[model samples]
Target: KFEQANGGTILLDEISEMDQGLQAKLLRVLQEQQVERVGGRKIINLDVRILATTNRKLEEYVAENKFREDLYYRLNVFPLQWLPLRERIADIVPLAQRLLAKYSRKMNRTAVSMSDEAQRVLQAHPWPGNVRELDNIIQRSLILQQGALIGPGDLHIQPGSMHTAEMAGRINSVGVSQADNSQLGNDMKQHEFQLIVDTLRETGGSRKDAADKLGISPRTLRYKLAKMREAGIDLDAELKG
Candidate 1:
């Protein structure tokens, strides 16, 4: 792949899936910017850019000794963590429209637009399967669609599916009181917000440690903090109190 993409970019998709042996070779190639062609040792010296993606946590994999620590550091030059679709509610309609156009072109259909109600429906769903789920649903809607607008009926999704009680976690570990727990029972969002606050305080405001305790990425924790602030939760005040 490096030889094929000489002077260009090559993506190592799901890099964590590469075993130790392959990881060693890849690390050498990335470090030297060169490769030896199989069955022909001409010592191909090439310039290439490397990009990688993975769903699993590579840091955890390194700690578990499943992934090469050196390779993890080499590929950790730039990391980007994208929030799940449900968290990116504002992007739903635009992404759907883009996908609709893409699939329409492939299907040889005229331009199609989602109805206002249909847009609302897409945004309302939890989207547990994320963008791939959205992609499949849009394709199905395109096929079942009538006229040029994909209406509410054209779309299909199981209601109340894959949502684990608004992703509620064990609040007992946070050390909240019985009275606060009673109020938390009434409001799930507030419960989650308070949980994060308590965890941060327990970690002495170390976001990384708090994220590790909460079993979420630090970037996700940052997003939650942003949401809490947007909801008018005074983080400083909460931390002090």
Candidate 2:
């Protein structure tokens, strides 16, 4: 009965992780101001306002059976999706400067500024991990930096930064080879020649039986034997009646 008497708000962070059973239970509490604890007889009265936040797309997860549909709709009443850092390049330099100042104060250091080249590097690099990754990189650069200004060398980011997924895509996009492909054709021919020799051996050098086992006419089998002989593959000796 806290919200009933005194106005207050409850924040549910990482709300996508909430279970279906809990979501159902929470739905009841949201619609009705009655709280029935687990295995409790009396329904405790409470007035609570919820503000749920999640980094994941709860609607997609709900569609995929990973999240509860009812709960997703309930919390998505007024949702605001923040844009990634890459989409807002203008803010990067200002953000970096603010971060630099914050780190400088925290570390009891001063005059730790980004050089022009370092600013260019930061602006070009695609921050996949977004603000968190940028914060970490700045922290690392601040720790490594000895001089007053931090250059691209201090940041340690190349001109065109590559993410793990991009690298993996490049690796997986490779096609089949021509040398091995050509060798495969030769291997198939050799396998067929070996099959004829083995089938003849199993049939005690009987061409008629060998032809039947190979699912080929006796005429075709005779032609194949001639080819094997020409290729220096001793089919009769290999067959060994």
Candidate 3:
């Protein structure tokens, strides 16, 4: 195709999927304005502009010799790194609005707008899949709703870290591995136990409001308090009434 289309642009979607050998061949084409197609010796003179996208770090691959250094250099000529959606919360509302308009027409529904609380939750979310995930979520929300206003319940994104990579120990010291999860659960229990003890002191050992504030059932809180007592948590002395 290089011979047929001598002066054109090629979009290499997910270019990182190319092997090192193929990357080296691509580098040659980029440098010399020529191409030798697979299983063909005849070199074709071409003036093709290359546009590529990769989510992976090409330089890291080049350093590991997994990607050709020369190819990486050629592609890095006018590199543009897009910030992930999590970093650009400001774009969330506008992007969601756009998607709403687009899918509404496609699905033969009235255009929808997100509720203020919905927008707040959407903006607060860490969108790891970037625009693609947002698109899916909007589509799902639109289809699920009969009304024109989208609520926070419509956008079912969980209210925390959005990816396995994001959940792993980088910002939070709590790693997301199985062992780390066990430790995290234990730590959370300890923290909760301490908070309950303190709250009990403030309420003069009243369990009702403390259970309400903590968003747990009274029975559940009592069960936890009993467990804490068994573990030798000096609830009364810690409170020091």
Ranking by TM-score: 1, 3, 2
TM-score versus the correct structure, for each prediction: 0.62, 0.51, 0.55
Error of 3 at 177 (Å): 38
lDDT of all the models against the reference? 0.74, 0.66, 0.68
Best by lDDT: 1
- Select the stronger candidate by lDDT from 1 and 3: 1
The CA root-mean-square deviation of candidate 2, after full C-alpha superposition on the true structure, stands at: 22.8
Give stretches of model 2 more than 4 Å off: 1-12, 18-51, 158-241
Root-mean-square deviation of candidate 3: 14.4
- The candidate that wins on TM-score is 1
lDDT of 2 by residue, 191-231 (tens): 45555665566678899987665545799888877866666
* Cα lDDT, model 1, residue 68: 92
lDDT of 3 by residue, 108-132 (tens): 6775688999999888887767787
Per-residue lDDT tens digits for candidate 1, residues 100-153, read 998777656686888999999999998877887787677656643436888876
**Residue runs of model 3 more than 4 Å from their true location after superposition:** 1-9, 35-45, 161-241
